[model samples]
Target: MVPDGLALPDDLEGSRNCGLVALSVVARCSYAEAVRAYTDVFRSAYQRHPRKNWKGGTTWSLVVKAMASLGVQHSHTEVTSAVTLQRLAQFTRRDALYLVCTTGHAQVVKNGWVIDQRGAVPVEQHWGRRKRVTAFHAIKED
Candidate 1:
């Protein structure tokens, strides 16, 4: 399962790489590995050297590139303005990790919880009131 061996950092107090952190856990690898993969994807796809702090933060485009580099297939769906816990539970699957995004943040949802650098918490608690879910990335097996 995706949750197996997945662990979060003790404190992401000052980190701006929530997307990378979530991707690392979902990819089951180290944060450095995730940064390397993101950089590789950026270089290969854009044909330019990524900024030194490219991996320090994330954007929607970067997330897509990272997912592609990690061999995870993804899709975008227009969700309603309000995504309740029940809807989230029904939208997610057990074997896959769901990369969810709101207005300014991204998180990994697995097994009814939000898996981020801080830790795994219920989706309702971490999700807050910003409910503009723009995309969903489903991790694929090797």
Candidate 2:
């Protein structure tokens, strides 16, 4: 049964789609308090995993899952200085950073904070092959 005002995502993978939906709702409602409460729950779920801290407690997969549960489908852009200050300011008393990416395609840096997709820059120009057509130069450099 649906809880009083609780809404469910169309997909059974509610853990994923729910977040995007929640974001939409919160955006429309401008309900930051409700949004924070929901996101806090998502963060708690993420921390439950045993390996959560292995990779700085910040894995793309877990971030995506947490966002999904909260109804945020996309990722944020770069992690910049200003963005860092902004995101740090958003942290609850709990001290967990909510991951928001710029675009849904893949993770990319934006501002200074690691948020969900907002806008994404193409990899072809900066990361694609130099003279090698199919080979990515960035990979070779590493």
Maximum-lDDT candidate: 1
- Position 116, candidate 2: lDDT: 20
Runs of candidate 2 with Cα error greater than 4 angstroms are: 1-43, 46-57, 72-119, 127-142
What ranges in model 1 sit over 4 Å off?
Answer: 1-5, 9-16, 44-55, 73-86, 127-130
Q: What TM-score would each prediction reach against the true structure? A: 0.71, 0.23
Which ten-residue region of model 1 has the weakest summed lDDT? Answer: 4-13
Show the colliding residue pairs in model 1: none
Candidate 2 CA-lDDT value: 0.31
Tens-digit per-residue lDDT, 20-42, candidate 1: 78777766667777778887766
Model 2 lDDT, residue 21, Cα: 38
List the global CA lDDT of all models.
Answer: 0.65, 0.31
Q: Which TM-score value belongs to model 2?
A: 0.23
lDDT of 2 at 80: 42
Residues 29-130, candidate 2, lDDT per residue (tens digit)? 233433454455545765767564332123334434544454444423344433322333233222222223322222222222222223222222222112
